[model samples]
Target chain A: MQEKELIPYLYRTEFRKITAVLCRLFGIEHITIAEDIVGDTFLLAAETWGLKGIPANPAAWLYVVAKNKARDFLKRNTIFNEKVSPEVQYSAGESHEIEVDLSPTNINDSQLQMMFAICYPGIPPESQIGLSLRILCSFSIDEIADAFLTNKETINKRLYRAKEKLKQDKVKIEMPSGSEISDRIETVLTTLYLLFNEGYYSASRNTVLTKDLCLEAMRLTHMLTENKNTDKPEVNALLALMCFHASRFEARIDKNGELILYEDQDISLWNKELIKQGECYLNRAAKGDLISRYHLEAAIAYWHTAERDSPEKWEKVLSLYNRLLMVEYSPIAALNRTYALAKVYGNKAAIIEAEKLGLDHSHLYHILLGELYATVDTQKAIRHFTAASKLTKTSADRNVIRKKIDKLKK
Target chain B: MKEFVMVYRSELMGEIKLTAEGNMVVSKEWENWMGGIAAQNKLVSPGMRLGNEGRVIKPGNVVTNGPYAEIKEIIGGLSIFKADSIEEATEWAKTCPILNAGGNVEIRDIIQVNG
Candidate 1:
């Protein structure tokens, strides 16, 4: 990369690494400081690199600069400065050199610890998502606001309050041990799941930014699958679910950035490697009889990615959705179950079930109704499509509904 | 300990217009600096970062742009610090990160006034 291009590129990859290590060094309460030092390192690089040109080894240069800033912060402000308050002694052995270890092992450990800390159950789910985006994903305040469709002040306030709550409660930045791991990991996994959905299904207009959010969520989930404390059937299941969904990321959107319905999508655009990875993780997740929602969802998604069109694929999908609803009840999941029902059974049987849902407000509900009614009652289908077109928020959804109306008119 | 306000002002000399990416990283540094003081338990009030552009409402009902006739240096922010004396406060002010960014901090003792 050229000198001007390198800063943003490094910011994307190294921001989380440096911040995690600094949080590990300074303690999670001082995360604002950790983030600050990381930002300063990048800012200084931008300023200096502009004047002096880029360093030969920019990433290493950043690490060294960040370490020095961390040390500088400690020496001037914290307990290390015995001169400021003579009676108080430095307890953490400020006598020894402050080690800002950025080694791969330390970095990974720190990031893992930091991830669990951000997902602490004490924090609200909204705050958890915000913290994950800022720290784990290294999204700037503005970028975060854009993704969530909020302003900078709200994001800043949410992050500040979350960190303060962590400090007040004195939550440790470490992995849970023994049985506690099960509960804690569940929270972490749930947070990651919400984060992925936020990225995948967010109403934000910026498709690229939303995709980044999903990919970042996947990265964090993958981290859990590797750690011993969190290495569970459910974690792998969640990873598999994410992988299966991500595999269709390209196929889901057309060249014009419009959403593509499942049957119409170009299967060739689907990522083969990601689908393979999903299969591997799904197999690993099969060993346990846990039967988490993620395992069921992942199985359903895997079926959707089958190479050839077959009724058997829809049958598998239908059964999994049935199991998933029994495992946990969600209206959206119930709605999805109806779609799979349409695929396995005749539209008449599916239409009978879909009407029971009575999800009048959802544009998706009307769209599904419109589809089911197409063969039985064309007039009803046109009316439902008109209703859906009015309710749909995005032009893409409206576009599909409009086409359906036009087809019925013809 | 005495209470003093450190007013940060900067001409922001040779301020190169930062790219959007560069702009993203700047706010955190300010937060880090303020949080440092608060962590020390010396921060009386975590002061507000002032706006660069403002309109001064004059004695009349008329409004005008610019806080001053000829504005150059900007008052970046203000925060109260607890230290033993003006000298100590000034010493702490010397370490303010704003100074590194072409800014200076003016330390002044807060006088007790009867309401």
Candidate 2:
């Protein structure tokens, strides 16, 4: 397989977890040095494994290479040159029998800690994710900029300023306690959710599917599960939510790279294993009495994945949305739920509910309302489709809306 | 082993906007400027940014309102270069973004006190 095709299989989430752990153990300062070693290690794996057949333990092989490389770097830079103070104990002659546990840092145990350390509630939430992506995920400054759809210079300034604040506040890599963890969890979850959406949205054209983003969120959620002190009911709910949504990754896009709406998607193409995993996570979440927005969203996705996955179950989906609305009211989510209601109940009800949504800023809500109007009230629908067509910036989307207008007129 | 500093300021206002094609151009320019110097291990650091509006503190307890001199003629970013002479530093700065916009290059010498 080409490197692009093999990337999803080779450097999976497990490798990222291992990398995170290794980075934490060896110190964040050694991140670049360690990453260089890891990069070379992957290159060697591509050459060796591609020819000699896959190794029994690929991650272990990569881990060993990373550790050895780290040791070599420390020897050359710190021990031999004495660049760092000699007090730093990087002794060369350690016992060969002893094994080093170069596991990646578990965000599960330390996500709250990492969050509080990075997110002081003073800096904007966008900047918090900017720092997290850098410090936690080890993304390059340019990579974060691409993710944010902004220039590298803007991202660089945000990261520099964020790091300065972290230094000024003297934030440590440890878990937060009590109410602080709860508050910080919001930022951490929001960042992860946004990260997942960016991946799901798959903004970059060449990379139609960024499994890395999904894997990153799953790895972070796994960290939450592992950390005894940091694990919360909401974390479990989020994990379930991610798993349920991720189950449909294969069916989300067509072979031609066109967007496949959920109603038209091939249900059989959904990953049953991921659905099973999501179920397990949902069960784990049920242990706690506290219900979260993740739980509600996951429940709705579970319903869609459960049976026929037809438009028939729109009522059930609407009920789940109502439940979600009770927990946290989002205009976007409400718009989605209203669409479901329109399908099950009728167009008039959907239009009435959607009109009250106050989503004047969103082009999508207008489009959805227009589509509904086309069926029940053609004149009103034409007006809406025209308004929506005018409101959108993307010519591609507007072209679709124009087609819809033509169909409605005919 | 004297280090020379080459400060590159964008001559055009909002002209440094990098499109996909522009990025390809700028990245190539960046590589030629930095990598050419880095081959000799003399490129200390390369930094670039447009102008920002902030208070400029001057001597005699004076504060200037804005990016100082001219908005169009503001300094974007600079590189603290480690080269043999001002000629080499000027040569390096010659390949800067300004050449594309018909702008000039400024090269400064670093004075050592201890040596």
Candidate 3:
């Protein structure tokens, strides 16, 4: 790959690995220091590679530089010696070498540990996600703010507060014990799901279809599946759900970056390999009796991957939506179910159900209503479409709704 | 071709608080800029970076703790490059990455004396 392409790819892939290793060495209190070091490593790569060309083994080069920097800092800072050295010497033994080990197994272990540390329950869920995006995914504050649909100041404050909380609580960087593991893993999975959705249904107008966040979420989740202690049915189900959705990534947006309604998307563009992998995970998820929301959602996503015009597909999807709402009563899920309701039952019945949900503030609700009323009542459809256009944030969504209104008026 | 010395001066280099990562980034920028000149066979000498510490001896045999204690700007480093003219050398200096960090490059023609 060219230097421009390789730098970013390495930045995304290696940022977490290097930070995790450094954080493991410096302890959680110095997470920012670790982040700074990793950032510097990338900046170095960008500058050096522009002249020297890409290194033969880029990962090793980063590890060595980061290790030397960390060592230098440790030697110079008396406070680190007093506070951190004892712990490092105890855990790693008295070897003066002070290796910043980034072996494959250690990398995996450190990441898993970092996941637990970031997802500590004391930190609010949104803050947890913010921390993960910043430290684990190598996202800039601006990018995290964009993901959160907020400004940089807000994200910066949130991350600052979260890091303070971690330090105050002295959160350890290790997987939770047996009983605690279940609860902690739930939070971790939720954070991962939100990260994936941010990428899948990105709020930013400029990067609606960027897949980096989604891919990062998937990469972290796959780490859970690989570990013996954390691997569970729900984990597989979430992976399956993500895989199913990712399979349609190509068909989700047009060249103009407008959202493509599922019915209008080209099914031929869906990835067959990802669909097969989703099926494999779904089958594994079905083995256990516990019916988590992930299982239901994965089932719904599975049906979405089927033949678009098939009645059986809609039937299965609608049923899964019903089950999902029973398990978790989110208005968004309820809003989505109304779409499936329209497909299986007629638009008339679905409109009744959709209107009762009282999601008046949501543009998606009005958009769905507009779609449902299109053939039945042109005037009502135009009204709903107009409302949706006003409620929408992005000009892309507004333009889409405006086009719908124009078509109906014609 | 004539030889020119390019001296890098920066006030911000001492004031800016850099983490290890930030230092790496700055180091990479320097490496890339220097490497570009080397690639073009225009580099006469890669030069050395002067540290913050040094001793200065005045003509009266009086010693001071170097670089002038109160000076805001310090010479961070210097390198020599072969260019056809001072204008060509200045053109190359314009691309120096140090300028991005609020630093400036001073280019002077290195006159050759009789051997």
Compare the candidates by TM-score and give the number of the best one. 1
Q: Which tens-of-lDDT digit does each residue in A1-410 have in candidate 1?
A: 88778888899899999999888666778899899999999999999999999988999999999989987887777544532223223343456456678999998998988988999888999899999888898899999999888999999999999999998998888777778888888888999999999988877878999999999999998988887778899999999999999998999887887788888889899999999999999998987557799999999889988955588987667666665654555667767777777876779988876775657888888888999999989999998999988987777778878877899889
Q: Name model 3 segments beyond 4 Å from true.
A: A2-4, A45-56, A78-82, A85-87, A91-95, A149-151, B1-115
What shift in Å separates residue A133 of candidate 2 from its native position after superposition? 4.0
**TM-score, chain B, predicted structure 1:** 0.71
* Candidate 1 off by > 4 Å: A79-96, A307-309, B1-115
lDDT of 3 by residue, A218-316 (tens): 988998988988888999999999999999888878897778877788889999999999999888877656779999999989988887758788767
Error of 3 at A289 (Å): 1.5
DockQ of every candidate structure: 0.01, 0.01, 0.00
User: Candidate 2 chain A: worst 10 consecutive residues by lDDT?
Assistant: A79-88
Candidate 1 residue-pair clash tally: 0
Chain A TM per candidate, in order of listing: 0.94, 0.75, 0.92
Q: What is the lDDT of candidate 1?
A: 0.81
**Candidate 2 — which residues are off by over 4 angstroms?**
A1-123, A131-143, A178-180, A307-312, B1-115
C-alpha lDDT of all candidate models, in order: 0.81, 0.66, 0.81
